[model samples]
Target chain A: MTSSNNTDTRLMTGNEACAEAALVAGMRFFAGYPITPSSEIAEVLARKLPSSGGVFIQMEDEIGSIAAIIGASLAGVKAMTATSGPGFSLMQENIGYAAMTEVPVVIVNVQRGGPSTGLPTLPSQSDVMQARWGTHGDHPVIAVVPSTVYETFVWTIKAFNFSEQYRVPVIVLLDEIIAHINEKITIPAHDELAIIDRTLSSQPPESYLPYKNTPSGVPLFAGFGTGYRYHVTGLCHDETGFPSSNARIVEELYLRLNRKIDQHRNDIIEYQTLDLDDAEICIVAYGSSARSAQRAVRIARQDGIKVGLFKPFVLWPFPGEELAELTRKAKTIIVPEMNLGQIAHEVSCATRKDVVSVNRVDGTLITPQEIVKRIYDVQV
Target chain B: MSFRYEIRLSGSGGQGLILAGKILAEAAAIYDNKNATQSQSYGPEARGGSSRSEVIISDEEIDYPKAVNIDFLLCFTQEACDKYCVDIKEKGILLVDSDYVTKVPEGKFTVHKVPITTIAEKQAGKSLVANIVALGIITGLTGIVSKKAVESAVLSRVPKGTEDLNTKAFNLGIDLARELK
Candidate 1:
């Protein structure tokens, strides 16, 4: 039965959109622990997943949450888990496991204030470094940070696609502001969305090697119960998935995992450039901070300042090349984040230009007026 | 003319101001064909805390989501009214619930003493739907969203089996707003 609530255009929170997008992207397994800001994702999935014949398990902790999704992914089902800062910290070990095992899973981190439960209800973009490096060891990650509720939905789908395509754990980073904010969104018809599923090994169970590397540096996954009795381990493993301490084998496995993402960097990086064609000053921001930057750019333009905006959705595998290319003509790049200059450092390193950082860690959003003030201050 | 209208709804947490804000935004964006965003603020406590929700309706895409200089403000409590009244733009609109907010602060903005709670409790039998009632009155007074669009949005968001009560509350609110006008 169709209802008005079921209409294409409805108001949705960013976390709700993330959950719905995951369902659309063929996610059948969700294991998450409730945490503020990110809890809505788990709450919505808990109620909705079962209706679609998917499983939603509220694990004991974030560690178990990520572990369960990894296990489910190994079994060939698209899986995900959502958490906030403290819980995200708890999931790091398992996140590392998922990365090392090349298990395809989407991890949503709705960022709240923290070193350790700094602010439960407030927003922060401090998890930028954590999402990329919190997981121990050298492992490749594709992290996407969305600025809008609509982009949250789109990027969640992209997160699933990238995870499956590259056989890597993908992180969708969201800040508290975006997570709680509700906005009108138009959900596209199912047929309109592009979905990517994991590639399965064509070789028979006897011949199949789960970790077998290919030219693309991605191995075809043969999930359990598929007659492909392949072993899965977090240790440095060879093509057969057996633990390997051999220096050469370890080197090859590490290089392959990194190369799988590095080689395909162009395809994985996604960003948007606003009015940069003739801009002299560019504002570099992402997630919720980008919203303020966009407004600042407009206000600056009105006052006849050649200000532009470069917003990156894909934070990791940091769209450095595209950002450098886009802001080539700009003399200064203003990096405003909820944190104190995490992404700003990357912007400086990538562009090799003067980067001005406007940071706020007070658990309040960086206002457009503040960005506009920076634009004027830097212009002179 | 390109314009952006910011509406702020404030009250205690359980008063459902957030839901009202969502309904108003949905009506503007979905039914009225505009760009809108709804954001809310509340204390850590779930209830009895000062809560506020803001919706920004724009002809173009909304860059900043939060309300800065509120074009319209609806306060269901005296505390919320006093706290947020200063943020309203000069000669803007400030709507206070007459039942709860008796002492209105003098401001340059237009003040409308809406008996939102009294109307909801008396006319609709359930003061729980006061938020919806406020939404209907706001729509009626501001004409920001069409009557039909607000009705559709209210029906879509209100809980099942209580649609009739909420609809009655909304209509009564519209009638009260008409009388004030």
Candidate 2:
């Protein structure tokens, strides 16, 4: 039924939206073992995907889960896997391989307090840096941090698009708070949403260089069984799918797989600016914590304290340059994260402004009051 | 110019606060045609710690889905009640499991002395259904939703095998809550 007004909604969690986005993005396969805060995605997909003519498999472990999604993607299907911290760590090896082999796969890391299973239910945005450097060796990654369930829905589609277009693993960085937070969300009809198809290998089976570069810097990917017989390997290869040790070839080839996402930073970056045009203070946050910070901005505004919020939806590429520029205008900058100054360090580098961190390690969202208090505390 | 209302249900994890909020939000959104959202805490160690679900319902598109000023508060443990009592909005409704909670100080809200566990055990003959009874009571007290919505939502939600027992527990809750109202 159509909503009475545009505001009508049905209650849903961030995990549910991730699953719905995958389905709406034309994801046909899922392979994941349930993990805390992120388990519901696999569970819901298990029940929902089969009915939608998709395949869902609970793999032996996170590694296998990611491996299966890679295979599924090669077989001409959009695929994804979900995990929390420990599981995220386990899948890193495969995630690196997805980057190397240029497989279009999306990984959902619903972060909890972690070094190793530190707090399973507690929320933490510590994975902000992990999404970038956690995969090992130079790799350009596309990761999106959603502030709300609605943004979660939209970013999931964007994540899949980047994975398919750039031919690499894209991370949808979620946390315990957003992953499990249920909210009323409206899902636009299938026609209203955009679905991305992978850049297929059009070369004849024998003539295919799976790594052939296009003008846009992304090599055309060969979905398996498309009559394009080619080899795929973890080893740095030449313009071909074959393993190559040529120093120049490996350097250039490895650089481009990353450059394909890096160079298109414009298309790769997704962020939101709230009250940024005129504000004396700025709060930088992502995921569920950003939602609370937005409220803090409104509260601060009501108190005649001019404040703005900068939420980098694209967590990895991190609008560092953007923040550097914002630091020029905004007098005080406060970064509130579920972790102790994870993304703040990046903000510190990007902006010359004295970045103040309002850390929350209690496994709960950093409240608006705490943010407001931090904003004023810095000035006073 | 609509106010976004976020109701947080806090208690030790596995106390069914998450599912209770889910049922409440579902009843409000699906049954009553209102916008609602709920989120819970998760961790390997969260089972015995304070866990909460926050639901936001509004007549307009909810720009922020997190709770700000609480309209209803439910706590099953002393810590939860102690943690949230001060922040509850004026004239808000507070439902505490009186058996587990003792020495509750009066607040600016309406405090109900519902022995939810006792009612569930005595009436429905199962403690698991205490949440359902609480649901029925809240629905009746608020008058914002019809019992049919919750009934349909719960029936649509219960696992395949245990549907009948859940319905019985729900009806018992409705009766109890209606009597209180």
Best by lDDT: 1
Question: Candidate 2, which segments miss by more than 4 Å at Cα?
Answer: A1-9, B1-6, B10-15, B42-51, B59-69, B82-91, B106-108, B144-152, B159-181
Top-DockQ structure, candidate number: 1
Native contacts kept, each candidate: 0.65, 0.63
Overall local distance difference test of candidate 1: 0.91
lDDT of 1 at A288: 95
Which residue pairs in candidate 1 collide? Answer: none
lDDT of 2 by residue, A216-254 (tens): 788777767767777889998877788989899988887
lDDT of each: 0.91, 0.81
- Tens digits of lDDT, candidate 1, A311-378: 99899999888988888889999999999899999999999999999999988889999999999999
Docking class of 1: medium
- Runs in model 1 deviating more than 4 A are A1-7
Superpose all Cα atoms of candidate 2 onto the true structure and report the RMSD in Å to 1 decimal: 3.0
